[model samples]
Target: MRRHQLAIVVKEKEYTRRIADYIRGSSFGDRWQVSAFTHPDACKQFVKQGYGIDLIAAETDLLRELQPELSHIPAIALVARLGEADGQFELLQFQALPLLLQGITDQFEGLCRKPVKGLAPNTNGKGALVLTVHSASGGVGKTTLALHLAGVASARGLRMLYLNLEKWNTSGLWLQPGGDAGWEGEGLSELLYAIKSGSSSHTSWLAQHRKFHPQLKCDYLYGFRNQEDRATLLPADAAGMVDSIVKSGCYDGVIVDMDDGMDELHYELLMRADRNLWIVSEERSALAKQSQMLHYGRQKYGETFGRIAACSEVVLSGINSELGNPLPAVEAALAPIALPLVREWRRGELHPVWSSSLYRAAVDRLCAYLLGESEESRIHAVG
Candidate 1:
């Protein structure tokens, strides 16, 4: 997806830093590519010669200094205070960050410009981006969110494969019985063996064994059977399963649901994945486990410890209260993608959970990050 360019011109360097850092660490980081300019002329030069910016959010004083050639450019006034004299295009510099972002979103949407076209669907040739969903604590709704993410992306016309790497296969709970021949071919074990053994027909084996879930609009393997078979999974097995699946050019993205342990297989998978969603809950024990998990990684992997952290983001699940940040001192991107506890899901029905509008909206946000947001959303989504 093409990220829109934004130019932030505020003479106060601190102001620019505050806004830029917030956006960088927020979901907006993916939507906008922001550049800070302390001097007006530099910003003006960038606007005139470089590719034009999508929006110039600057102090009124800065905007006034620009030449008339830029008079018609999309712009918003960054002010210390709000007043009637200030047009709707003006945003207060001191308002809540979310409010300021909302103001920018509103003003930008109101612009009478060409629609922002979403880029073409992710081609299989691009090789699916591996997104691993993991948690330090179990029963945290990790697989559920992973499944929703895959379903949402698939619904957006992007091909997705939902793979469960769990030892006990918790994802099987959400999946209906007598469907897709669960664990029949003992999912991916043979495929991985073929890959490690250098069998040329491994790709053919993938297509034949995997079945499509009609509702998810996504494909999934029958899954692996027995802890003994799963225990044999090696660090190199990540490439054998995920990398091989991607190489097949069969899907745009692979959503991996993994167990809680940070074993060699888990480490290899997390490090190899393009993005990682580390699900966290409000419980103190869960948070402590996550913290310990990171501390352990830093100690065991040392120097190379932060690689996985760099690509990882926290996803808050079953959060019912207004607690500030779930991962204290943890840099969250876009308010942690808060998820609601759906009561209907307790009926032991997957359809009710999938159909829940609230659940779908939250998953949509995660999907927007994975696969670009839909055309209609590009035109009007506030968040």
Candidate 2:
């Protein structure tokens, strides 16, 4: 395995030693070949000595002094205080070692913006993981959680395309208009239309309409503006679009935001998905609806539903913050994961940052788990 070279330059000898020790002892040791330096001069000497470094994490002073030499290498500025980033990437000087590692990893991920070359050959035939997020009930914060997961992954440098196939398509409000699409991209609507009309290849259509959301750090397709366009989406068309996105190699994977309908379309999506996230609120009605939906799926599809159910996990979403434990009995009862209610979101405040929020913290853990799980699945496919 050709590990990426990472250089850590900090004035504090002890801090550099601790980080080096942690990286060597942790899974990061496999991905990163760490070279620690307590002085900028030594680091400069090493760089001049023809040491190839993929990334550098250094104190602001060292990074500034070495700016002439590191004009090309991706660098992370270690800062002691929080202030305006001023369009420069930075990480706090002190943090949990794991988070620090994750931060650095995210930067590396952003650098490649594609499946790491090392992991691609040892995985499934698919170009990327397929994640379908659906629910038996609506208004359970499914889209929000899905977007946040994508955002967290994007922030970490893992790429994904957010596809909202919901009928009403409320998630469109969050995505900014960019890429070739600009403000009037009509991505999902056009793609579905093209699919139904059999006009062009999926790859061409996808590339033509895909938009980049700057804030979320993920590529996304804006939903159909017209209700009729959404109504035209067929089960096969939807599944085919997702499959194309997965095989397109345009992203690390696809996050399909599904509606609350228990129909043929939903079943096709769930079955095709590599990972299924069934989002449900704590409301008894929502839980009942989910149970009834499953019952019907099993009664109707039998063995097929069984396979989908086996690969699926029920996640508790919109857990009330008023509660002491947040998870309550639901954690043990249904969900291996729970998404907390963001009171700020109720007031129409979009999350601008992920590093500090409790909500982001939970999402970071979930994203890490999903990526790790996907990695395991990829390796298993190799076996």
* lDDT of all predictions: 0.69, 0.70
lDDT of 1 at 191: 67
List candidate 2 stretches off by more than 4 Å.
1-124, 177-183, 197-200, 321-333, 347-356, 371-383
State the TM-score for model 2: 0.61
| Model 2: worst 10 consecutive residues (lDDT sum) | 374-383
- TM-score, predicted candidate 1 vs. hidden true structure: 0.61
**What TM-score do all the candidates reach, one by one?**
0.61, 0.61
lDDT of 2 by residue, 279-317 (tens): 878687887788888888888999988888876778877
- 78 in model 1: Cα distance from truth in Å? 64
